[model samples]
Target: MNYKRLLFCLFTGFTVATSPAFAFQELQPSDDYIQVSKEIVEILEGTHYNKPSINDQISELAFEDYLDALDPTKSFFLQNDINALSVYKKRFDDAIKSGDTQVAYTIYNLYLKRVEERLTDLENNLSAMLEGFDYTLDESLDLDSEHYTWAKNKQEQDETWRKRLKNRALTLKLNGETPEAISEVLTSRFKNQLKRIHQTDAVDVYQIFVNSITAALDPHSSYFAPRASETFNINMSLSLEGIGAVLQMEDDYTKVVRLIPGGPASAKGELSPNDKIVGVAQEGKEMINVVGMRLDDVVDMIRGERGTTVTLEIIPSKGTGQTSKRIKIVREKVKLEDQSAKKEIVEVTRGDDTYKVGVIELPTFYSDFAAQQAGDKNYKSSTKDTKKLIEELRKEGIVALILDLRNNGGGSLQEANSLTGLFIPSGPTVQIQDQNGRITPLGDRDPKIAYSGPLAVLTNRMSASASEIVAGALQDYGRALILGGQTFGKGTVQALQEVDKGQLKITQAKFYRVSGETTQHKGVVPDIIFPSVFDTEKVGESSLDRPLPWDKIHETRYPIYWDMPSLFPILEPRHQARMAKDPDFIALNDQIAEFRENEDKYKTLSLNENTRIQINEETEKRELDRENARRAALGLEAIESVDDIEPTDKLVYSKEAAEILLDFIAINQLAEREKAQQEQAN
Candidate 1:
């Protein structure tokens, strides 16, 4: 199961559904699911800022489009299936709109068997339109012109894909192998492991083809057989136990991109970003070969409950192109608390007096709904925890506080408002408008202003949504000096409604600042811009094949920087002078150069007998060097190794860079403090 070939089939497009080994009934529908889902929808629809007509249109159309794409015969309804589908749609919509995903879950399975029947007949009865073999555009779809080219490419890719899938299906039947057994073989084959093992690579290829074809339809619409669908449900609920790593299909071998801090993977100490998973088995059981298996099937074999041990045969990203090493890991639920506000005391000495700057790292404004809904007073909320941390920082006699919002992808809106209230004197946090041209402002009436001391808000390209709200509010009211790279331009506010609850998350509206500015394409420009490593200026929706336009409204005035003298311009030159000689910044440029040179590093894997197995053991060293150089050039400390630089899997973007970039804000903090102190004396 060559992962590269699997990747090819996936990108090319191939798909199907199969019955599961075990027919597990879904969990009973719960009212709580409905409450949570509808609440989310309501909050989104009640945009307190601008006319979110565009968001509304996209969500509604996407929902219909996704459903139609999934089962055109049912959603579009032929004469025979029309009446039945119409009734089902009514009931389905009723279930979906009720805000109870649990109810929709039941409806989904009710239709699952029906879907299976259609899939079985697809090979025999599908017309050219259904086959999608014809390259002609579906005039009825009236698709974008660019997508026409995408379709042409898809058709070409699909042709190659069908051959692979057909070959796999025929091979599987001739061999008389079970799907799960085939799955294990496929998984194992991905990492090149089917020799002594009792399986072939065809199994893994089938699953990848099925998934890729389904995914080509939309971001959320996955083509999962019953087993994979079951796996999907577990993920949507956000409650799973394993070495909590977000896996990615990098070419063929599934790679670990992020480790969930509280999970076994993070605790294991051996795992890191870019490590590839090759095989899995239960402790005491013969390790199952899983190298090139389909992601869902492989995941099914690995994931288990808490305290349970699962063995992972990992082929690490670097080090001795070794044989798949088996490592046993215990699984655990992801504790949101582990990802809560963390405080670090940054020691800074400008002269004789050293400043203990309390740096608060906020990953996101997260709030655990299930725990909070249960009347847990100590429930996790960013504002509440941050407010608590501010008091603690004050207790330590901190000279300044840095609110680290880099890579914070935002969380609870209420928390964002509450966080804003800590700075702004209980005014509106942001405004939202609906399609009907109605404006609604989300006001913060709480009079609790938390830390009013000298503050510097650190931001970067990944600081988005609630991060923007907090940063924007603080910047408006002269409370904190903003620093770091530009904020991530994610001004659009999304409301996850019951569209299918966990089936699909929908974007319902765009939020706007009180001044009527929607943080859409344009991110918040910090008072002073530092040279950030992630220059995603060209990587946003604005750069998409077809995306919305960037527009603005009347500017809302806040109480911050407006009245402050030219602090940004003044500090810019001084910081520039220092950055010019910074060793760390120079090192960063070196790393970037090396990275550019060997980016084709993966591309050059020689399948030639001797060259392939001798993959370099020096990759970790090289990677560490690259990171060290880049960080150094940025005026940061030279990282001794990758151990010195933690890959911020939890942060929204590259916030690890933001953590080190915190030093650059020292100038901004000083300027603000001096101004405030001089004003007090005057």
Candidate 2:
């Protein structure tokens, strides 16, 4: 994660290198780096959950990871360059263990040389290349790097780059830029990229090399340089500042990975995971193109004092980067009250009976650690607030309850256990298995049930970590019906250790459900799946690289509250029928399908100007058509294209969950009445 965008809260918040060979001084590993490298190896091998060995296999994987990190698009290095670097391919393990970073440094220095060469080539021929493109030609460019191999030679690389440059022009032209503006933007970006490359320091190179080795073992483990370590500490302590987003460098773009629950972006609900930020502007300033910019530099530009606004030119996660939208967020402290549990009452009428359904939206499982340690009895915590909210909901005459954990990317494990206890009797809520293969069950020791009425838990692909623990626990105990999309599978525990100069966040343990199923790669699956806009392939823990594998251990002892399976038959059919015909749901499904089709088509983009124009127009038309269709179905007035669409306050998923909870209540009522009749007859 980029330190600049590390936290929407107070704290949260990548780079490159090279050489006198390209009029830039090459970075050499300092004495600190050598000692730190050895320390990292010792810690990872001695205490990491996987107990990874520093062997040839790990070295080979690190080599690939390092290369990909440097040039993910494979545009900078040639096949021959890679061939030359292969000698160090299997030497990284020994290098790290022996405190020798020459292998990593050599590879990075060469990569920097290639970057300088490519940018220089672009700079030298920009005018001729810009004038030379024939948009009428039926050519296409493959954007997926995995589909490409290293260019055989400079000519092959030039041809690939020529098409790329043309595509860049075409993209900007389609976005309404003039020929002069496009030329200026392209020239400035190329120059800026080269300038930033020259600015790369030893810390940048060291962080990349160490991370490559750590990430080779598992996606969750990583090394943070001194600067990044400071940002990480701030994130753990502060909850106010910036826009509350975690950003990473993907190719040339800074991508939003996660939006902090209480941050402005999450609250605003416009910025989403996987959205690529292409440009940024301060309030009342011109938008600065950020393509090929360093992650920290971009962050520096985006961060501001509280109450100030920063606008981002975002290529939406759902779009194929051809179209973009701007979002403006006010920088502010992410207050605990803002993230606190909130309750709502939804009234659902079936035939004649009106049922009041309680809805609690928990953004994150948070606790005030400072206050708690200070013996503050009323210290802010998710469980305590939720318990109070439930009491308030019960007072409002609600008969059923729904806990909405949508987009809750887990927080404190203690909160997860205590929160789960609010609905079930004392029992193990989650199990942790460490490197020693010993299982430790962490559960709610309290015997009190906060709200035991007909219950349903709503989750989505972004519901992760602590969220998964709570959802999985309730589901295993048959205490609630899990609804919505599959939860984010992030059940691994990470602990930060201070190395010689920086910090290392390493995976230390794994989380399992009371049912013995590990929630690492395969998050908690909902009992009633809902139509989701999130693409499984693009979101969730399973989508990450080298995620810990899913396995099971012995099940923990816990009493079931209900025979949930028996009720699924009645609920599943009703849900399917309702969602299939529901106007909002139908529209959602159509939009997702359209987005997916665009994704497939965007794998390789047409170079023909007319074809691209036609495609963009058709996409907008389809989007407008779907919007009008949905409006007409709901008997609302329809307006013009794209511009006419407005954000609605309606909670579509929550409404559906209310309907499901109503059905659950009805089922239980019928069972009770039948039992009474039988008893009377007997």
Error of 2 at 149 (Å): 1.9
Q: What tens digits encode model 1's per-residue C-alpha lDDT throughout 228-304? A: 44566675455887667767554345777546544677667677556777667787886665544446667767778
> Which one wins on lDDT?
2
Candidate with best TM-score? 2
* Predicted candidate 2 versus true structure: per-residue lDDT over 1-682, tens digit per residue: 2222222112210122222346766667778777888889999999899998989999999999999888888889999778767767888999889887766766776688789888987998999999999999999998775688899999999999999899989988887899999899899888888999899998898899888899798998999899888777777765448898888888878999888878888878789898999888998986778987888888778777889999998988776655678889999877887889999998888888788899999999999998999999999999999999999999999988999998899888989999999999888999999999989999888999898898999999999999999999999999999999998899899998998898999999999999999988889999999878788877888888899999999999999989998999999999989989888888888887777767767778888999988877887898789889989999999978786776442378888999988888889999999999999999
Q: How many backbone clashes does candidate 1 have?
A: 44
Model 1 whole-model lDDT (C-alpha atoms):
0.53
Cα RMSDs, all models: 12.6, 6.2
TM-score for all models, in order of appearance: 0.58, 0.95
- lDDT of candidates 1 onward, in order: 0.53, 0.86
Model 1 stretches astray by more than 4 angstroms: 1-238, 245-299, 309-330, 368-379, 460-462, 485-488, 495-504, 525-549, 561-565, 576-586, 600-682
